[model samples]
Target chain A: MSNVLANILGASPVMPLEKHIDVACRCAEQLAPLFAAANRGDWGAAEKAAADIEALEHEADDLKKEIRLHLPKSLFMPVPRQDLLELLLVQDRIANRARDIAGLVMIRRIQMPASIADDFLDFVDRVIDAAKQARKSVRELDELFTAGFRGAEVDLVAGMIEELDRIETDTDARQFELGKALFEIEATLNPVDAVFLHRVIELTGDVADMAERVGRRLELLLSD
Target chain B: MEAQIVYIGLAAAFGLFMAWGIGANDVANAMATSVGSKALTIKQAILVAAVFEFLGAVLAGGAVTSTIRKGIVDADLLSGSPELLVYGMLASLLAAGTWLLIASHRGWPVSTTHSIVGAIVGFAAVGIGMEAVKWDQVGTIVASWVVSPLTAGFIAFLLYQSVLWLVLQHEDPLARAKRWVPVYIFFAAFTITLVTILKGLKHVGLEISVRDSYLLAVAIATGIAAVGAYFIRQIEPDPKAEKEQHFHTVERVFGVLMVITACSMAFAHGSNDVANAIGPLAAVVSVAHTGAVSAQSALPLWVLMLGGMGIVIGLASFGRHVIATVGRKITQLTPSRGFAAELAAATTIVIASGTGLPVSTTHTLVGAVLGVGLARGIEAIDLRVVARVFVSWVVTIPAGAILAILFFFVFKSVLP
Candidate 1:
């Protein structure tokens, strides 16, 4: 029902074969707002998006169970049912990860730290851009399935990956600087909080990496 | 008849030894990628290789036994002289077996074919003078050492470059890339089927015309490619992630290619090299039973089965070590690179076999590894180890021949 819930459901069919497109549309809508909140550094809004994602995941699980129950004897399917299931699981993982990042912001309960917030903001923007590209590609899956288009997609993914790597490198440099500053102001800050912040930055980078992996897989599938 | 039985026994034992050596060394060729990718554990790899190899050898092994027994050597010279024929076969088997065991223990990958040729020469020299051995056939076999690996390496290098250009270098959007994947799959399938049916199943009496076979192979390949493409297209793309997922996909595709390559290698190897073990057995059978040499002797099904079984046992018991040496120690084999090397190696051997050239799979694979290493840069290759392997190749024939001669002479003296 909510945008967050819809994004979490992703573009996959919901069950009994008829609801898949509807669920997929819901998933896309839900994901857009989460990205927006992440961009604006609205921690409370991000937490709501995360809650929507959690609810969507529950819905997907329920859908899967229902599909299994109704189609218990149905052997023939469009594709290998297991493969479809795996695809759904992987898509759901993307939503889950996005939600987890949002939840982390809420739990930290601090205004975006002034020191590295801008850098984090920039990295998030790049990630959103990549996700947007992926969504567009998925929408045009039929046209892009040809060799000419698939070849272009592979190149695009490669470029995005390179940019992601570059941003990660920059983030690492910033983290190093922040670490030194934290040590300098050790009397004012808890060392444990610094460590936690460091972990959060690393996890954020990992989410970007997971997104790239999905891009590469899509490229291989479409191009081959 | 008594003497012929003894020779057959000796031949059977030799065949078993050859099988052991193959199981010990060649199984790695098939399972190495799976093991390296951690897709299959070492123990799992060995078990799978052993079972599939044995099944492949026994169920599909045809004409290979007869080719090995009668195709290479002149049986006329040993005609009417049962004693000489028996002695020659026994001597050849022992010599070849000894060479293989030594190579295995030392972690060398000397060809079973090369060792057998040397043993045959040694026995032929003693049985009917040096003139009885077909020097031209021997020359062809020797020439294959240089030809097989170089050809395989070159082809593999090209294939890898093409894959890189098409998949890694292309700048299409994800949807477009997904669309093209079917074409690549089609090509891969076509090539694999064409090679397998024509080369792998050649010995089996699959009475289809070559043209028809090619057509059928292409159609099947296309179907497989289309199916693969459809599934791949359904997944979403996110390019700003780590590249491990891409690597993982490459690994899976490579694994499939390697399996097909291994199957073809096994089939071709069986058809061609069955002679190393059973050639002597056939020679002994003719000498003791018919008291005359004959080139047309058909190896009984039982004898061929024995040879096949021996190979299975050898692979199960002692093949793991040799596989490890080749798979890991030869060069670091990433899935894609290893697949390229194997495809090159299989293609080279198949062409050589078709043209009746007895090329060494060992040479071809090593050459492919060298080719890949050079592509990466020679500095990355361990030249000293490669040099040692090359030197061993030069010496295998002579060493095997001399051992055969010495062993035969001793057996002759002791028996009388």
Candidate 2:
């Protein structure tokens, strides 16, 4: 019988629940490198980091399944098993989103718009900062849940969200300006480059949005 | 014994229904601003209001209810005719409920409390004499209709302006303003608690000495303000020159203050408005059981509990629509602006309740929204909708009284 099948009958697992959380954290760590590579404009490094994120996502998923299977029968589990499961899923989403952004960047192979590049970079930096806070807060979940943090983490995440919203609004205006500028140069530049540039600019906003969503979900978990 | 029990039971049931309606309708007055701002979802807002409202209701004694029943209406004239008293009580309930239902269905936000007051006036005028009603108290209630909203509007305007000037207008590098946002929030929260407890919980029947109450209020307020100031001063200035971060932080803090303010309003509302549901029932109970109206009739504990529970159920089931109408339909609300409106409305109503003045929550919130709307621009006021709501307010009382009288006569004839 497979070890998984044996474990179903209540045998001790090879990798414990703590290992799964560690694996999830590792996946989140891998994502940070991918985001860094993208920020540095290193296509090759970004592609490699994206692959690492995907592998980590798979590992995290399998661990989550194992945790779920053991949850009902296990004599003891950390916090409500549902909360841990939700935390894992939120972490997985962050990694998957990082991978998705990497894929968009690689597939388009388009140049970033100079006018909005600084704004986009600032948004990404804020997202990373929120993500780092979420990770630190989650690690101290016991303290957060037992002693009320007075929703500090939630407030922090919400602040990041408001910032993301402002950035999106600014990006919308910048995109319109860039689109008009690109249209004026339509005769000189290839139509494909223009299309790719537009997609990349839009994806940048989406990536920031996804990161903010993860921050919000993590904040909810801490507060709940 | 049987007659007394039946009257009490009837009062309990009717009071429960009225409490449910109050919970269903009035909670929106507090929560609308938060929900409109998208600071909290409709579901989250209702849940929080329901819990705090229940806490406020159960912990607080029903001094406010007694005040409404005896202080506003002359029970001396109401003595000696159980049949007429029963008829009057039933008439008022039917009148208030019918008007509220019609107004709610039409999506016009109207005051259930105001409707009840009007129905009481109508029934009292018909049953005894116009002279029997305490015009002095009635005058106070009417004045509150104007006072509450205007006070709330003025406060909201000032609060929003201060927020704009202190936080939104300031140009501080290294996000220095961001650090102070939390301190300002603490002061806002402290003031909200002090005002709410002083104005809202006074009716709860603690009977604390006035000097003691004021001292406690000041102590609580100062303590909170000091702690907030300390933390805000402690936040290390950011290395990045991100002015937007400061603005966003201020906005979020403002939103938090709004939520706390809404919570205070919900608590005070339960203490004061719970009477609208129980007043008639108590009158009915007094008449059916003792065959006389007494100034000091005590409502059964079970009836009060039932009323509180009914409120929770009503809020869970039907409160969302009212909340949406107030939260989203009236106007678009940003966090800072919504906070100002909620704080203003809460402070106004709390003060009114303390001074034994009856105010309309609907009028106060509408005025606050209008104040914010004016700040935005005249075009944002939506004058057509405002006109429709105004017309409903004008018609609500007489319409409710007529409907209640009609319903009472019909039920009386059909039941016998």
Candidate 3:
């Protein structure tokens, strides 16, 4: 690297993790508008929200890249590099899943049925909440780091992970209910639409599941 | 065996080069936040640093600027062979200065204090004997490396909590800021000046008794508080900014305090680091003039001036990169947080300088910033940078020692 670029490259590894978490949180935020717009059959609005999610996911990718590129080979990290990179991958996956769902929605123009509209929206809302919970937990890395991931901070994050699991489970149950409701009406609807709707429902649930995985990745980091 | 103009000239040149490097790299740590946070523009920061650093070295550098590395090497060992000590001093300075420049070029993070100490120990062990290197004093300095930073951390933590309570969390933040900010300013001013008066400038001919120093400390504190209050009074409350961040008004209250602490930090650094550059230079001058190395002697004013001027010139020329690294790395500093970090760092440096202890001001500052991050702002800091810094701290001493060992033999063979 050139001298001017070298300083900038080696310089700001300080808070890229937090910056990454922020991008994750912002990407999670796009889910509500994306779904709400799809519910109204506003393809333009849904596509716009999906585009926003794509942009945020790209930002999170760049921050992760900056972090990886600048991470010195001889650092004395309290948490190992492999664990941090694992955490980054898992955290980035939350944004990735959200983008995936948004991309599917924009691509298929999946229309929301009146029967499952409220319940499906609630499922997406809970998934976004889980993603946010993961962001909040990741943010505690600083305190956990300063505390060396022990004592009260560990307990606090452990509690956050437990709550995230609960939220994810609750979201899972909601997805199942929405799925049941979709199936009940499946025979009366177009067969192709039923298949596509089921696929979209599973992908949306995957967003929350991936967020919970981010939390578990931290648990492994702390315990290890 | 005439050690004439040549020896003294070599010492002065190396000494000036070492001083320039410190001003460029180490001293920038003092004013970094003020420059980084835009509290002081680059030109303005450099000007402020130049003036106060000059004042600090002239007024307070004497006690510390002896012809030795704070007695780390036993000077008595070299009395029988004064010329060897001269060559050792010259070699130590060159080795340390060369290591610093190389480290900077390679983007290695290391402390100048560590560089000089390691160089002195390496040369002493080779030139005189291993016994001539004062392990007891070296032990105390090594222990202090841990003690001083923890002390600064504890100080910063308390300051952060107090600032949080006084203005950040209070219902009426403006009233609290207007009422309490100047008091904190007074506290910082009084403590630093008290240390300076009691400990730093004894050789400047004003040996005020401890009682008089206390009186002076109090008088200066109250005067500073009064002027600071006048400045605080003019800052009308902006409710919009307060609504934007409940902590905004509180941060504003700390703006003046941060600038004050920054100047104190620069002053403290000047009092301490100028000595490192000029100590060996002073020995070379003494040996060349008197044809013998006295175990101890007075530090000439001209030597102090050379150390001070070299630092200033270095800061003017090449201190920007060091300043940028310090100002922008580690953590994002708000004015209040910067105030706490600098205040704690200044306190540590002042206390260390007063009693003649060698410590890295940057390490203490980093620890203070770490302390703040531990309290409630950890998310803002980059743990990776802190880790890299720790690795650098571990590497510098051994690296400097090894390099000095190599250079000491080369200097011995080459120099007459």
Candidate 4:
């Protein structure tokens, strides 16, 4: 039977948006394994990690596109449709950065200098943590929508975004320290190796930057 | 006398057809939220709808029936020739049923209330004269068509906002829900019961004073609340589920409340909508039995029972599938949100019924859902569909009018 009431409730993008961030987070999570395998000189395992990140990134891209397709302009949502699309774009980039960093490290077979190896790995973990934090924050989209982006739910998501900003800031500091360490060892290593290592550090740092942007987009939705 | 029997038979048949259409289609909107939210399974929803819809029609449908039977048409003008009233009522029923069939086939968002009202006005104004149609009463009904939805929407917005403030937004939402859900239950139950006792029971031969009505409504509501609280206390929080979605157990608490609202929704729908089917039949029966258009005659109890029986039969035969399909499509309306819309719509429609206004239940519900959406409760609503509903609202009246005018002319020429 043709039911106006059923048809009136367009497909909700909240759960799908939540699931999209989940996939993006999973893609960024592979970075931890890629670095761990690389530090042990296990090229085979590192290649597998890179491939896994690539696959997850592709999954995230598909989900992002599907969400966009369903979220037509005709939908009347609590938040602006454009705001949600922007949030989706920032979320997708987390996976994009993860894949990019993995590709750069794998193709160049770049090895960290012994002095900065531990510090660099710690830096990678911190950046991954930022993406995880973004995921944690985005996961609250359902609750945020439920509360109409006001009152206690807004405060709760604000706290999450605050913690995400702190993680991103810590990643920035780690990136600065790693850059300085690499600068000191430039003459000892091959010139090309030194340049590519710096590029990888910058690209790895961009993951945290993108994760922080996800928080920014979500914050825009929280406002009246 | 033989022709009188013919007129009554034709009127009853057309009336049953109209009631069947309502049960087959409109009832789905009334019960879908409960099933969609998993607050009541399909079987339970059907049972609740059948029982409560019948009660609403037999006990509370009198006022709107009177409005439809005598309020729209100027029966005084047709008192000298009562056959004209019978033919007009019969023609209006046929026009509405035919229009509903065509509209449903084409998947248009048409309201049965709009169709019947339009057909009645069409036949009276065109077949008789403009003065034969009560323009002031028609104006009031048309105004109500616009006003009811807005009122339901406003109530829904406030109700959902209260839910957010008093329960969902609290840090310990589960505890707050347990503490406050029964109070909401009491309110929902109280409003529907109070209105029915004060306005509906009079036709059923029970003249409850205003003071006693309040006492009775409160007693019934309190008992329902106590039972609801017992159910809420039984729901233990699943820590595993709560870790993923914080409101897991809290929604369960709301589910108990949704069941109560669903019943009210069905009752309200029956109270208002059953009149669309039986009002014309009542007019035809009264005219045929008296051989005069006597507006003062009481509506036969059997006619109300017939309308109720026809609706239940329609539900058993067809509405169950419609309910299932609609329920599956609207799973986005979880118990917490569904209850708000249902309660708001039920309150608005029940009050309208008490006031003898026949408002569209679907339109009222659509308004309530929009109200919740305004409060940011629903995830998404298709504005395009809403626009289409508005378009149909304006179109159905004219369409029903034109069809009714045609049928009136044919009945005038053919019927004795």
Candidates' TM-scores?
0.60, 0.60, 0.75, 0.96
Please give the interface root mean square deviation for model 3, in Å.
Answer: 8.4
| CAPRI tier for the interface of model 4 | medium
Candidate 1: tens digits of C-alpha lDDT, residues B319-394: 6664554444323354455656666665666556555555566667678766654443111243444566677788
lDDT of model 3, residue A71 = 67
Off-target runs (Cα >4 Å) in candidate 3 are A1-109, A112-188, A191-224, B1-3, B67-70, B73-81, B130-139, B164-179, B233-245, B295-297, B373-377, B380-416
Chain B TM per candidate, please?
0.83, 0.85, 0.94, 0.99
lDDT of 3 by residue, B42-111 (tens): 7777877888787777766665565244478787777787777777888788878988888778776667
Question: Which 10 consecutive positions of candidate 1 chain B have the poorest summed lDDT?
Answer: B374-383
Q: Summarize candidate 3's per-residue lDDT along A1-224 as a digit string, tens digits.
A: 01211121233343678779889878978999998999998888988999999999999999889888866664334466677888888888878888888888888888779889988888888988998989888877654543445555567788899999999999999989988999999988899989989988898888888889989988996795
Clashing pairs in 2: B95-B404
DockQ of each: 0.04, 0.02, 0.08, 0.66
The 0-to-1 C-alpha lDDT of every candidate, in the order given, reads 0.56, 0.60, 0.77, 0.92
The per-residue C-alpha lDDT of model 1 at residue B11 equals 61
Model 3 lDDT vs. the true structure? 0.77
Which tens-of-lDDT digit does each residue in A29-144 have in candidate 1?
A: 45445645755777668667667766765664566566555332233222334544554444444555655655665676533356555655555555555444444434333222
TM-scores of chain A across candidates? 0.56, 0.56, 0.91, 0.97
Using alpha carbons, what is the TM-score of model 3?
0.75
Please, what are the lDDT tens digits per residue for candidate 4 over residues A9-101?
Answer: 998898899999999999988988898898789999999999999999999999998998888889999889999999999999999999888
